[model samples]
Target: MKTILILYYSRHGSVSQMAQYIARGVESVPASEACLRSVPEISEVCEAVADTVPDSGAPYVTLDDLKTCDALALGSPGRFGNMAAPLKYFLEKTSSLWLSGTLMGKPAGVFTSTSSLHGGQESTLLSMMLPLLHHGMIISGLPYTEADLISTQSGGTPYGPSHVSGSDSARPLTDEEKRLCTALGKRLATLAHKL
Candidate 1:
């Protein structure tokens, strides 16, 4: 089976929920599977350390995971119109992968969760795409062909799938948002199979 590695960092769990929906979409494609991984939180107080494994949720991502995946779906909570630091920290370690062109020509998609409707959801998605573009990954986004793009009031973007979690960050994924996430996942997996 082809594996679509979903790597994300979520502070309030909304982005993680989005990842699950994407995973569902990936699994919908025959001969495709989702491999979910997460990055640990970064501490502001003199470099916080974490256990090798998280207490809950997916395990921390490794460079090997990026190297071996057939495709990738990257997600993160929006932070000032950019991705969270933990995910960026992980990506920074991938210079070796970039040099080796390990992810060159692989399919990739991006997703994000924002605290408000104007929380830079689109910009955050673009920010995450920068590194993937650097790796020579084929970036994928939701096409207008997905009806949800026209109807989604909560969170869905042509750049990728997104969610509006509200200031409290407790909002659940809307039906339209969920559908877009799944569609993006299916698109990534299908492209991986073809490419």
Candidate 2:
């Protein structure tokens, strides 16, 4: 069976919800499964240690998970239009995987949750893709062909699936946003199967 890792870091719960939706999409496939994992908050001290397991939400992600995933659906809460610091810290540790070409040719996609209409969701998604591209993963985005991509007023993008959570970070994902998230996950799993 193919494993699609749904890796994410959510500050206000929006991105984590998106990850669950993406996992639902991944599990919809006949022989594919989703492995949900999350990164911990990064401390400014850099020498600080984190608990091995989070009290709630997904467990901390490991290099083995990243290296073995057949496909990846990355998610993050928009932090100044980029992924959160913890997620970045975790990704920086992947140099060893990059060195071994462990993720080469794997299918991958990105997602984010933003607070405003213009809140850098696309830029965050694009920046997240940079590392995946460097690792030789195939980047996939939601195409306009997806009906929601055309109709969404609340956060779907050609770059990837996104959700607008409002300034208070209280807005739930619209139906279109949820559907698009599922669509992106399914698309990644299907492509991984093909490749």
Candidate 3:
């Protein structure tokens, strides 16, 4: 079976839920599967180290996951219109993969969650795509054909799927957001199968 790596970092849990929805979409493809993983949180202290395994949620991702995946769906929380530090830190460690061209020609997509409707969700998705681009992966975005993209009032974008978690970070993913997430996963899986 083709494996699609769903890697993400979540703070208040919105991004994590989005990842799960995407994974469901990936697994919907008969010939494809999803490998869900996440990165450990970063500490404010420059020298602090996190546990090798996260206490809850997905295990910390490894370089092997990136090297072996048939496709990739990267997700993260929006931080000042960019990806969160934990996801960025993990990407920084992928220089070896980049040098070896391990992800070259692979299909990839990105997702994000924001605390507010205008809290930079699209920018965060775009920021996450930069590293994938540098790694030579083919980027995929939600096309207008998805229909939800044309009508979503909550959180869906041409860049990728997103959620508006509200200021308290308590808002759940809307039906439109969830459908878009699944669409992205299925889209990536289908593209990976074709490639």
- Higher-ranked by lDDT: 1 or 3: 1
List the lowest-lDDT window of 10 residues for candidate 2.
Answer: 41-50
Using lDDT, give the best candidate's number: 1
lDDT of 2 by residue, 1-195 (tens): 999999999989999999988998998988999999999887897646478889999989999998889999999977888888888888898999999999999999999999998999899999899999999999999888899987888898999999999989999999999999999889988988999
Deviation of model 2 at 82, angstroms: 1.6
Q: Which residue pairs show collisions in model 1? A: none
Expressed as tens digits, the lDDT of each residue in 52-133 for candidate 3 is 9788989889999999999999999999999999889989989999889999999999999998999998889999999999
**lDDT (C-alpha, whole model) for all candidates:** 0.95, 0.92, 0.94
TM-score (C-alpha, index-matched) for candidate 2 = 0.98
What local lDDT score does residue 40 receive in model 2, on the 0 to 100 scale?
84
| Candidate 3: 10-residue stretch with minimal lDDT | 40-49
Q: Which segments of model 2 are wrong by more than 4 Å? A: none
Candidate 3 TM-score, true structure as reference: 0.98
RMSD values, in order shown: 0.8, 0.9, 0.8
